[model samples]
Target: MSDGWILGLDLGTSGLRGVITDETGEIHAEAAAPLTDQSPTTWSAALSGVLLELKPHLSRVHHIIADATSSTVMLWDNGVSSPVLMYDDGRATQEYAAIRDQLPADSAAHGATSTLSKVLWLRNHCPVSSGTRIAHQVDWLNAQFLGFPPPTDWNNALKLGYDPIREQWPDVIEQLLSPLSPPKVVPSGTPLGSVQEAVQDTWGFPHQCTVHAGTTDSIAGFLAAGAQALGDAVSSLGTTLALKIVSERPIFSPSHGIYSHRLGRRWLAGGASNVGGGSLLEMFSLEQVRALSKRQPGPKRGIACYPLRGVGERFPEADAKKAGLWPDKHLPEAVRFQAIVEALVAIEKKGYERLHALGAPAPQRIFCVGGGCRNAMWQRLRSAQLPHVVAQTVERPPAWGVTRLLADEGP
Candidate 1:
């Protein structure tokens, strides 16, 4: 195995994390810095701080890659003045409607929060000069090391309407985004160029060290799970329960919030549901949930519940007007908590079932990640609900996945 180390950085919603891993994927060192805000200044500061923390090991590093939250966008002329429009920003409703009218029904850009919609919105509301460049969060972050104009990966450009399969911007999108230039697109893990001279001089990186194209944070997390077979899957139990499975055929059902990201010869198909740790947080403190989860109750039929943080539902059954359901307030707290856990597992099973019906292979095994994975009781409950499928937790964060990409590309 090569002795050189690889650096992976993940720019998440809450913070920036960097991991230094050897050729075999064993982490040598890791560091993180929390972001106080979403502005380019804060992001750049956090990134620099994290890299400084990893500075001691820079000389051994051969490659660097980064993943950022998908759909977060910024406009740049000489430098950034405005805060990035985060992935969840909903100010592009009119742009979304216009995109829906222009693109196919199954296009990922049909949603209001998509990068395409945000680009259209920025064009009219946050106008930039003709010489300006538009870039996704990952693109901008990677450019900090590799220099501009920024280069983007296919996975990060999906919501921006770059057709990965065709490896080109579609005529419809080109017409809609007239005058503004799209960043050069390449596959995730493709090398952009060597780290800039200024970065190398400051960080002590080797002259040969290079920066590779990166994916979205979600896709990087999926890669970290180490799932390679057709039926392998990864389930994220964060604010929402998100699922993605490896498949030979891509699936797209915008109505159900299901989409696919290309993974080499295969596809990663899945969707997110409005049910997860957010439901448990509603009634119990972190300490209370930890204590309550340990006191397993005897087998009892769970109360019917749809544990959403608020109104509306996506995946399994997509209904914008769907209301969140809950057990009677009079029920014991332990009972209510267990019932909610079971209900979320049921929703997970329904999500997998939906995927199966839509042509994706049934999940042969699942690797779990996110904050909820810490709850052993929830893991047990999930395993019991999907008895035939093997379930386990992957402790590595998304930064490690980008390290894997670097290792795959070699020194």
Candidate 2:
């Protein structure tokens, strides 16, 4: 295990990406394939394509770990099920309504996008077979190598009603999953089973290579930032702005889109704001954004803009009918864009304050990832707003995070 390489794969909505790395975090090779669709067939073929692309180093690989979109679910008997339920698929409203009232406000299972809701919907539409089992996106792929349905990781099982705090499924889940069996759940890095002989022959992996459980894509991304102790924080400035801080205690505010995900021995508590890069893109082109950000250090526009691309706010505040505010249109585009950036930093600041108010400690240091991280002005603005919080940069490839699980879990 010490001498061989570790392969970490990420089953993303758009593509499958992987990196081959050693225990010390030195990357040897990387491979990726576009996912035509989020189907088992597509994932199987894409995984093979990636492995074949990295065939030259396959013999040196010892451990395999993978992360996928949380809440994306499927079924398995002897074979995998069809019409995969995607993470964003909200067709389970009826099922969600039936059980949502029964779940606590803090419960991850209280949404239409939850895995429990999707599985309940699937069970209702399709007859459940005797040996059928529930599987997450990564769980189904792990089965290809293990030769049977494998246990899912805690991160992927959260919305499936497997409580991380108790480390077991509650009695309430039985009401929703009457006929189907939940996967035996484990922590993020627990080794499940060895790669089957046939898979080793086909993919050129070692005979005894192990496949370990992985987390949700978001958690994997968080792990990549290297926040180890309590109060360490990481922010993702993607299509949506996500804020997370490692805390000694769990925080739950589902109404504001805030909650906690167990991160090893601690809890990661934060929230997601609907206002993010998407809102910026609505008024300016990519080039315009970059140009405006570069000129930010020289800006004198004192105007403030509250730009919300969507109908409501989720994090920092909970309002379904919230409206966005914009500065006067007569102002120069440069001034306007700078105002938007300042607004975002305000929103991000408000978010952290909200977390602190809800029980999370003040952030010790903050690391940022995603498309917005490239904005030098935004980083500067964040520093100015949260003057006490140390700002650091880190590589944010989620596949790299999945690899850490194997590296940290010693033989």
The superposed Cα distance between candidate 1 and the true structure at residue 266, in angstroms, equals 1.7
TM-score of 1: 0.95
Error of 1 at 120 (Å): 1.5
Taking the tens digit of each residue's C-alpha lDDT, what string does model 1 give over 205-249? 999998888888988898787776789888898888999999988
lDDT of the candidates, in the order given: 0.83, 0.83
The true-versus-predicted C-alpha distance at residue 273 of model 1, in Å, is: 1.4
Backbone clash numbers for all candidates listed: 0, 0
Range of the 10 consecutive residues with the lowest summed lDDT in candidate 2: 387-396
Query: What does candidate 2's lDDT look like per residue over 1-411, in tens digits?
Result: 365788988888999988999998888999999998878889989988998899889888888989999889987667848579998798998998889778866787877778999999899988578888888999987887789888899889988887778888888887669888777888878889899999899878998799988888888787787766778888898878889898888888877778787777789888788788877898889988888877646555667677898677778876768889887778778777778888898999989988998899998888888888888888888888874555566775888877876665421
Best-performing candidate as measured by TM-score? 1
| TM-score of each model, in listed order | 0.95, 0.93
Q: Residue 178 of candidate 2: its Cα lDDT?
A: 86
